[model samples]
Target: MASTSARDDDGMKERLRQLGLRPTRQRVALAKLLASGGHRHLSAEDVYAEARRAGIQLAYTTVYNILHQFTAAGLLREVVVESGRTWFDTNTGPHLHVLDEESGHLQDVAIDPKALPLLNHLPLGDDVEIADVEVVVRVRRRNDSA
Candidate 1:
């Protein structure tokens, strides 16, 4: 029987290969960490913290570089809800997100793409095309003043 770590490494290697990325040791380790908890939105700092908790030794720049590589390879999606703040999402599909203003966390918003009428009326020129749309709804706790 293969150990969990071995299985995870193999899985990460295969996934990276499919994405046309070389699965270096650091990449594999980071991929395993990102893949462990199903889908999530994580920053480089979040990943670095997780790696440290797991006793994995690597530099912060290594994590940041690997994250960008993964995003370029379509293995992850980059979500920027605020200026200078980015989150890497494991679920690389068409969907919207909800940002918690108080906690600074992101959650997936389930809505049919076709139901959005605004997307159908984008004012683009003939020479331009829309690549992707990212919508993040920000929310915070309401005060009891009212």
Candidate 2:
């Protein structure tokens, strides 16, 4: 009988293959880490830290490259909060996000895209089409002592 870790590695390998990405050792390790838990947003540094915790030795740039590669292959979604800051989301489906301004953390929120009135009408040229819509509502902790 195959061990649980072996089974997980095989699954990750198959997933990577299906995405047209070669399943290298490093890639498999990183993919497993990203997909192990439920979908969540993570930065490159976050992934690097996790990899270290898992005893996976690799450079930060390698993690960044693999993340970008995965994003290009549609396996992940890139969220840019501001200049020089980005997060990779495992949930590639259509969803909104609630960002904590103070902590720089991102949490997925369930809100129907149709409910957003701005998407109903856009002032773009007819030749233009919206590929995707990413809505991030930034919030901070309330200061109750007003």
Candidate 3:
């Protein structure tokens, strides 16, 4: 089901409307791509390719615009795990990421908030909310693992 495109026949319209976005074909298709089957750390290019393969008929600018809108509205989290690629995650919870240096894949690594030391010495003047603390643990894959 993850690979199958379920946008057209599914009830994606209602979902987008609930998020205060008008349910257009482009928005519905993008929303379904983000919501259904499985969660992923997708890049804009990844989303554009998927939408194109699904015959969603959207320009690259349209995809990027909708993604920015969704991120601004708190529907997605954008992370820069690598140089030149920004990843979008459907999961909004505070967490860290483990990026495989060899494969360039990003994976979530949950951390206990209590485990972190208090940083009261630093001056954060009431305007800062620590949304995410990402520790990109870069590791090379073992030769014998496969």
Candidate 2 clashing pairs, residues 3+ apart or interchain: none
- lDDT (tens digit, per residue) of candidate 3 on 113-145: 434576445566798866555555667867995
Candidate 2, residues 1-146: lDDT per residue as tens digits?
99999998999899999999999999999998898867999999999999999999999999999999999989899999889989999999888999999988899987765468897687878898778888889999899999
Task: Kindly report which residue stretches of model 2 are placed more than 4 angstroms away from their true locations once superposed.
Answer: 123-129, 141-146
Query: What TM-score does candidate 2 get on C-alpha atoms?
Result: 0.86
Indicate which candidate wins on TM-score: 2
Scored by Cα lDDT, where does model 2 land? 0.91
Q: If the candidates were sorted by their lDDT against the true structure, best first, what order would they fall in?
A: 2, 1, 3
Model 1 per-residue lDDT tens digits across residues 1-146: 99987987898899899999998999998888887878889988999999999988999998899999999998889999879999999988778999999999899876755458897797878998667778899999999899
- In model 2, the Cα lDDT at residue 118 comes to 92
Candidate ordering by TM-score (highest first)? 2, 1, 3
> Would you give me the overall lDDT of model 1?
0.88
| lDDT of every model, 2 decimals | 0.88, 0.91, 0.76
> Candidate 3 local accuracy as lDDT?
0.76
Candidate 3 worst ten-residue window by lDDT = 1-10
